[model samples]
Target: MPEGWDGTTRDPDEVLYEISMKEDQMLYEEFVQRLEFNKKKVAGEVKCHKYSRRRPDDGWNYMVEKLGAQAKHGVGGGWKFISLPDGSSRPLNDMEKMR
Candidate 1:
């Protein structure tokens, strides 16, 4: 129950805009629930993007394209995990006795 939950006769567009903003601020789990709730509440009118781990960066790329924004970079400028670590690093997926 936030400040603006009085259920007044405000503009529907304004309400939808606020709801969209709040949905964007929600966490991953909460976002999923909110999307489901909104989809049912709005009768499939509200649009959203659902991403899965299998397609990690596709949604990000789509957002960047839609919003006309530059891609984000990590501290090491998009380097892989092994590249971030110093010294001789072995693939965590590759497990074998170092002869």
Candidate 2:
């Protein structure tokens, strides 16, 4: 048997205390983080930022290097998304360069 591995030999109350303490610590940390973020927001330090979600395989370099996408290429390139001039984006297949 492993060291101190006696079956049912440990103190049950102590185990319960340890588990509760760990959970409480986790909840307290999360609350503190939220409180800090709120404080920053109220101080006008938290600014809204546009964020885009992309898959691990979705990126400019990945498109260029892995998928053989031509840089500065027209539509129909292998990139997953096409960035618009208005700070928005769409799937590359949805756009076509006009003649």
Candidate 3:
């Protein structure tokens, strides 16, 4: 009885069902897109961490060597690694000194 409904038109229930199905399909597609985006974002973060220059490892031996060479010629601050009570060590930067 609606404006576009004619006497020969399909059942109203069937039309409503079809519209609901299309809406569900669209929502599913959007969910998939968002999932893929999150996957790519996580992958990019992993890649950046893997290639970052300041990543800590092996008791900061690499950092010590690199900073040592720079300090040997009096070029920068005497940055050193400090071991915490929790058994983890990190480089003592200027910001830490302020704290």
Q: Best-fitting candidate, measured by TM-score? A: 2
List TM-scores for all candidates, in order.
Answer: 0.20, 0.39, 0.36
List residue ranges in candidate 3 displaced over 4 A: 1-7, 41-99
lDDT-best of 1 and 3: 3
Tens-digit per-residue lDDT, 1-99, candidate 2 = 788776666689999999999999999999988898888844557776657665444434222211454544444454455565545665534334222
Tell me how candidate 1 scores on lDDT: 0.49
Off by over 4 Å in 1: 1-8, 27-99
Mark the 10 consecutive residues where model 1 has the least summed lDDT. 59-68
For model 3, state the Cα shift of residue 51 in Å. 13
lDDT-superior candidate, 1 or 2: 2
Q: Enumerate residue pairs that collide in model 3.
A: none
Q: What overall lDDT goes with each candidate model? A: 0.49, 0.61, 0.64
Total backbone clashes of model 2? 0
Better of 1 and 3 by TM-score: 3
Q: Report backbone clashes per prediction.
A: 0, 0, 0
Q: Give the per-residue lDDT of model 1 (tens digit) for 1-99.
A: 579688767899999999988877776668778878776863565554575356444222211111214434433223232221224333323332121
How far is 8's C-alpha from truth in model 3 (Å)? 0.4
In model 2, which regions exceed 4 Å deviation?
4-8, 41-44, 49-99
lDDT: worst 10-residue window of model 3: 57-66
